[model samples]
Target: MPLSNNKSPAATDIYTISRLNREVRTVLEEVFPTVWVRGEISNLAKPASGHLYFSLKDSSAQVRCAMFKNRQSSLRFEPENGMQIVARANVGLYEGRGEYQLIIQSLEPAGAGALQLAFEALKQKLAAEGLFDEDHKKLFPLFPKNIGIITSATGAAVRDILSILKRRYPAANVIIYPTLVQGEGAGIEIANAIKRAERRKECDVFILARGGGSIEDLWAFNEEVVARTIFDITTPLVSGVGHEIDFTIADFVADQRAATPSAAAELISPDSAEVLIKLKHREEQLIRTQKQTLHNYQSRVELLSKRVPHPQQRLIELIQRTDEYSMRLKHQVEKQISNKKMAMTEIAGKINELNPAHKITQQIEKVNVLEIQFKKSITRSLEKAQDEVSSLSQLLNTVSPISTLERGYAIVTEPKTNKIVTNTKHLKSGDQLRIRLASSEIDSTVDSIHEK
Candidate 1:
């Protein structure tokens, strides 16, 4: 239906819907150029257009507020439903709906976002100083000998870090540099603690940490002194200043940054279980190498004994050398097995010591499995080595001339000269001769000589 602007004879100034909405918007804008409205947010809608449309209301009344993408960029915190927020906005009337609304220019948490601005400022300053450079960031040691914790003495952050460090790496020595993690003078104390730890050079890594809190509560970590101190430390520092969502100036300057205190502990320590597996692998590799070396030695000995022509004395020396090598190989394998076993025992003991009650049973079962596997591997290696040694001994015996004596052979020699009489020309009748058999020697006088 086409609506006409029908005006009474006395009412010459008739308004259309568009003209009315526009006039109302101009008047509203003029009346409230910039107003600070504090209310609880509701019906929050963030569309793909990057505009936020939400209802800011009190118990009795509500006004629709629209924060465009450009204006929302100035928000210090994301506006969420049920969030108590204060917004600076201009009052206007929407022409399309003829609805009254507020166009939000900026937003912040009601009376609680100044610290965030300060945090951003300090972060930028430190970053510009190269404190946050990747080159300046040191990788946390895989296995720190002494793990230093800098946090409140009685806070949950300390307890969490200690618990995690104990569970993951019980062998590491923990040194707590207890200090205030919040409030006045906390930043100075934190900086001093870092300096003390650095001067003493006792800890391999440090955790600068605190529990999650409000921005103001965690402001100490955003202090310039804390950032500078963290940047100057040679020992790597991990900042777990707050919860995963929270970050501070110290986080930017620290060598490593973790989401929480427990995470910081994880960054600095090696898991005992993983270390055990790696040791097992190393032991197996050593066994394989030793086995291969022994096999090669055995093969070389067998080849030389069967094919190489040498004086009897020289062959005897070669056999003695092969025996020495076999003995050395046996000793080496034994030594390696002993060392690996001892190391595994020590590591397992450490793991057992700190195993949580809930996990102890599982840990014990795993250790048992590993132990059984280790023993089986050792047994196989020993058996294989013994078999090779036995084979080598048999081969040595088979090539020996003494073995021929057992086959009904005798050697005739001059008794006085102890020289073998290979030919009859070397002996005469009535000459004393010695006959050597497999088990005994006999004395004989040669009355007659047989040529062949």
Candidate 2:
């Protein structure tokens, strides 16, 4: 069915052919401001003015398009009549020809656009199945002995990786498995190299590397074959496909992704210089500890040598000590004899002193002295106590509430709670209160209120 332009003749306005076409073009442009169109190029024409005029068409439909020189100049590949492309363009109408057309903003080969879509679809598919999950990824060997590198044989990527590995860690053995990083069979070659490396099982870690390029150039890393190969490998794989901003399916599937080939080498290898410095530090510490140990042993040996006295000297000291003891014994014996005579006289005196009458007299004298001292103490204590009591009584009477009332003041309290009534705000003229004077408490009602 075809749309008809039959407006009723009796309607107020009739459209001319040009006006009708203009109206249609406006409607078309408004309906589709911008769109993405995919088709093969046909009727392509370049009039030497640097502008491109072509018809984008599929088997069923075709639309005229014009790409300005500014836009065409930036295209990565030349446009040919039969080449399929995807274009981002604005819908427009050529008022002169009364034809609707596309004003192409940008376009790329269908292959590249399709690759982008495929990349996303495959990425999602792999992620959903947990192929890109961290749990599936292997841990990088802490100290890798052999490192396997899969990259182009003659590309700068391999050179950069080797240079970095050499600088960072010279001891690790490196194995290079050269393969095409891009082109038709690149993905398969890379995948096969990975499987081969795993079969060998010589390398502790593998690096899949490539230099920076357009997404199409680095598309091998985005291939499903390479991603799955990386995921299936037991040895840890690090993807270094391009610059930091570029990411590929291999990056997610690999154990880790480095921003560049150099970064991948640095990531897996320990710095030889730093390791050497650490070892030197440890050696210095061991030397210091050994030196301290030897010094302690030497000091101990010196002290023992001083403490171990010669046999002759030890004997001399023992003889001197015996002579001193002999002299002390003689003096002690003489002293004992004298002491015995004196003790005889003293015992005779003590026997007389043990007489009961004499002892009773001495005890009576002691009792008399103690009795006098006790009487004095008691009298002094009583006097001190009497003085304290008199002072406290005076102090108490001076500050007593009764004393305060006797000085012509009264304490007023609310009879309801027996609380002091210092504020009149809570009282009314007829409220009951108790007024306590010096000697009596009187019940009263609040009189006519007053305030100062």
TM-scores, one per candidate: 0.60, 0.49
Top-lDDT structure, candidate number: 1
**What shift in Å separates residue 160 of candidate 1 from its native position after superposition?**
1.1
lDDT of 2: 0.74
Cα TM-score of candidate 2: 0.49
TM-score of candidate 1 to 2 decimals? 0.60
- Residue range 1-452, candidate 2, lDDT tens digits: 23369634554366777888888888988999899889999999998899999999999999999999988765877899999998889998898898889999888899787776688899999999999887887888666778999998899999999999777766678899989899999999999999999999899899999999988999988888898888888899998989998899999999999999999999998775565455346434543543454345334322322333334444344334333433443344345334533543443344322332233345346434644554454345335434433444433322211123455878899887877787898888889999999789999987788888
Q: Residues 408-445, candidate 1, lDDT per residue (tens digit)?
A: 76899998988778788867789999999978999999
Per-residue error (Å), model 1, residue 238: 0.4
Query: Candidate 2, which segments miss by more than 4 Å at Cα?
Result: 1-36, 39-108, 292-452
